[model samples]
Target: MEPASETPTALLLIDIQKGFEHPTHWGTSRSTPSLETNVASLLSAARSYNESASQPILIIHVHHHSTSPSSLLHPSARLPGTETSAIEAADFAAPTGTEPVLTKNVNSSFIGTDLEARLRGFGAGQLVVAGLTTDHCVSTTVRMAANLHVLGDAPDGEGIFMVKDATATYSKGGFDAETVHAVHLASLDGEFAQVVSTDDILGRVFR
Candidate 1:
């Protein structure tokens, strides 16, 4: 998070919410056990970069708030009497100070939210993405970030850097958690994002 880097590559953390903690709903286990630690590392570097530079680094948090009251993500479902939503960002990834938080109901963070507009407003052309459920929100956001022209119409996700170790997903169908995670990353690699790792991004961020 040092050096007079170029226009800062914004970090987008999506759907890192409490409801995903339900193993039954997601899976018995998740793909990456180090997901929290990896994302926290990226977050720390982003904060340092923001604080050290005049041009602030944008570290945005996007949470999913399910539309249905029965859904685990909805406040009525998880909090019950308290009515507090499970949409609260995980402790390590929560927004602090001036960082922005966007609540979304769909897989893509850009849909039904001001995410794209915010990125545009901040002039954030490059983005480093990480989050829960690698195949869902994280993958969708990365694809839309390219297809929707949010990151300047790069067909091959030129501006989107998807951090592999920082993202995770659960098993579905007949597949296992690790298999699900690997397949999604492979699918999103060349077509939707430049699949990267925490150390790889940190090196570039600190460059």
Candidate 2:
């Protein structure tokens, strides 16, 4: 479907699936308890970003379908009649009619999916990305979006937007989840993305 915004910015939600919904899935620990809620709010704000505009902001869901049989995200791992499945999108961020749902096995959404083409098709020059794992898939997609120059080449993920509170990550090494999350945001801010909060995005980008 065509974008409903004059500016035509795309909201790219990466790996916002049931697989990583709870901390138990990721060693039972994660940083942001409000990640899903923040993203949901973002989605709502983006959809109604410009109510009077002819077109609204385009929405794209990037799902991670793991090819590895042992991985939870793999299709086979999601058994029938289960309470939740790894591949299913979270309730708050599920795609609606006509919204594009791009699946990928790798971290970067642009790697093997038609995400780039879809963005180009929708004529969304700017991208606002939010989803799972600040240092993993989210980081990879942001870096790729900057390097790919979809929003023009200035390097250091200048044109793209990354929601700080809307993304989360698990603890690893000697660090805690909070530190890991903070560090990733700091690393990506300016260097890989704008890294703004959900409220900030709603106020600025949508406005």
Q: Taking the tens digit of each residue's C-alpha lDDT, what string does model 2 give over 1-207?
A: 123343568888989888775445565479888897899998888766645656667788989999888777887665334756768888899888777899999989998898877777776656888898898999999988877777654565765888888998998887888899999889878776897787877776776
* Alpha-carbon deviation at 179 in model 2, angstroms: 1.1
Clashing pairs in 1: none
TM-scores of the candidates in the order shown: 0.91, 0.89
Q: Which prediction has the highest TM-score against the true structure?
A: 1
List the candidate 2 regions with Cα displacement exceeding 4 Å: 1-6, 50-52, 79-83, 153-155
lDDT (C-alpha, whole model) for all candidates: 0.81, 0.80
lDDT, residue 64, candidate 1: 89
* 143-176 per-residue lDDT for model 1 (tens digits): 8888877766556677788899999999888899
Candidate 1 clash figure, as a count? 0
* Alpha carbon deviation, residue 15, candidate 1 (Å): 0.6
